[model samples]
Target: MSQPDQAPDQAPDQAFDVIISGGGLVGLTLALALDQGGLKIAVIDRLAAEAVLEESFDGRAAAIGFAAYRMMETLGIAQHLGEVQPIEHILVSDGRIGTPGRQGGPSALTLHFDHRETGSGTEPLGWMIENRRNRLALDIQVATRPGITRFTQDEILDIQVEPGAVRAKLKSGTKITAPLLVGAEGRGSFVRKKAGIRTYGWGYDQTAIVTTVAMEQPHGGVAHEYFLPTGPFAILPLTGNRANIVWSEKTSRAKALLSLSPAALEAELARRFGDFLGKVTLDAPVWSWPLSLELAATWAKPRITLAGDAAHGIHPIAGQGLNLGLKDVAALAETLVEAKALGQDLGDLTVLERYAQWRRTDTMTLAISCDAFVRLFSNDIGPIRALRTLGLGLVDALGPARRFFASHAGGDVGDLPRLLRGESLSPALN
Candidate 1:
């Protein structure tokens, strides 16, 4: 083992089947998924193991969709998750406080989604896992995952590409050469920029304030999304009487609200958080994120590709960011595993294009739909508000339509990959 912040104990001129930039949750998941194809993989991350293992990781939570949960199980890490909260029911409502005709009675124009709506009566629609717990699981999963090498606290300084191979040089004087390179980094991917992929999108005038809250009453395993005029405020149930809060507001207001004292912040929270959950108080540091929409013009290059937030970033109104990345994991894993089994070069542009083609339409459709959702719900216009409320009501009244929406949001209603369907990646294993 290498010392802290040092290169791994391997040959200086190590080679791998795939070299991945970024050791984040998405990146680690991708590495594990590709390893199932019997391909050697190397992960380069600047964060130290200690930082990744810390108990307070960004103080955030991820909503693992039903399909995403299955993918996690296939990667051999789901059972290791310390604890997770089940979201058996989801409620969507329009009109936040200060909006016209908004009385804040529970939630106005509400739409409820039941887990049975997905036709899986025994399973939850989704699970809420803490970011810290997920990262810890990834650390252990990567350590146990075969065909993969982890380079912690090491940065990829430069990359030299050729038709046959790509060589990545690290700051610690270690060099790795591979035919396939992936950028699972976040939106500002160093590999994506090096591969000459351009991104286009704009930041919303809104910002999301995230934190966990402890409630006086149980959450009943329900998630709530209250569409405020400024943005959406969500209370996602956590392991106990605690729930994760993602309150979106105008950038200016969020800034002011974040500056409030603990008492003032709790007061503001109660204003948006209804009494349904009883008293609510902040249980963690309040964090805010600027909402935005950005997508890579293309998902792949000669011998390089991107996944997760590196490829697309959408508004969090739907809480599908991580789910989208998990979908990428499933699709890319399926693509690479299928290609390797056929004796095709996994790095071949044609082979990589298959992955891109598989994801292109679905990703864009999600981005556009999320953007439209934000646009529609963020408006305070009376007629538009009434129309959206009626729309929610219609869906609520229509059982089939409600179920369709439920399954779609649960991420079990689309063209799924083998991993997401709980199938083996390697045909021999099957």
Candidate 2:
């Protein structure tokens, strides 16, 4: 890592309320959430703001849950995100050739979830947003907030936990102190490592190839998932008749497939995607990410805590990675703010413990659920495939079960954080 630029006036003795490493989505959102509390916050990142958005599309997008959408609204950043596309329905199906002996006669089972059925009214279950857009909105919000200080082109060289504060040394020879330190640095977080925290998880032997495609027909704001033997192939609705595709395949095969010509790649995609959307053409550069399931052994200790991918990384089969991180920002912010009101040290063990306890169960549950779904559906075993198809059929036949899943997808599960519950942390921006 390169050295950070030094601040001429050093105030190591003066402490900030929080020092967050890695100014990605989670870190920036957390900073905004704490901005209203009259606390001093400093966010450090290695990359400059402009460098983060140099690429268009970048083959990455996030499925922002309804609750997260509301949280963004409370943060006064949602409206700034360009071209929000709602996903009104989600369709899941198993794409496997069945024998004639099957009871359903080789018909593919479809499980559909509609947001309107759950009294969400006209509101969407979630919005599909390009990752860069979300980051840009966050950067703008952070820049406009009065109490937040942002440090770009800065890298953390070392961290030390003192009796009353956590001190961080930047490579630029500048030092900062804060009562609480948050790690939002992503999967391979340097902050988590400096704090001596350990994680337990394994990588799946799969690589996810992501890109955008222009389809003959409009997506109609529907998200489609096809469970093939290799992995799950998802087509998320985008603005203007375009769909974002995330196709997970075996590692070796993914490398070879990625090497194919654009025409060859489009041909393979159309073959697997079928003609439901008519002929599809590649519209963006392809990007690939390895699949993994990672969980930190502990979320908080002393004045240190972890959030977002820094704490837990799960399968994208459910598109809940960013949603989960947003939840973390909400929970941790709430805990600290409420603690301050009650005259408790924001970094007190009891206060941090509360935040950890609030998030542990939900994070683990989602991780296990996604992992299980990926494993159960990503195999071509005859008996297992039959069981899964039957299960989907049963879910489709049941109304209450379908609604339950829909509610979960709409981000209505668990003890929601205040922002996610549609309560404003600060006054709405005009």
Give the residue spans of candidate 2 off by over 4 A: 1-14, 97-108, 117-121, 427-430
- For each candidate, the alpha-carbon lDDT, in order, equals 0.86, 0.85
Highest TM-score model number: 1
What does candidate 2's lDDT look like per residue over 1-430, in tens digits? 9778556445344468899998988999999888865567999998888888866535688889888888899888897897789998888888753334332111356888877544365678799998888889998888888799887999888889888789888866678888889999999999888888999999889999999899997779999888888898888998888988999999999999999999999988876776667889998899999999999999988889999999999989989999999999999988887787687877778899999999999888889999999999999988998899999989988988987777676677778889887675552321
Separate clash counts for every candidate: 0, 1
Judging by lDDT against the true structure, name the best candidate: 1
**Which ten-residue region of model 1 has the weakest summed lDDT?**
98-107
The alpha-carbon deviation from the true structure for residue 20 of candidate 1, after best TM-score superposition, in angstroms, is 1.0
Q: Tell me the lDDT of candidate 1.
A: 0.86
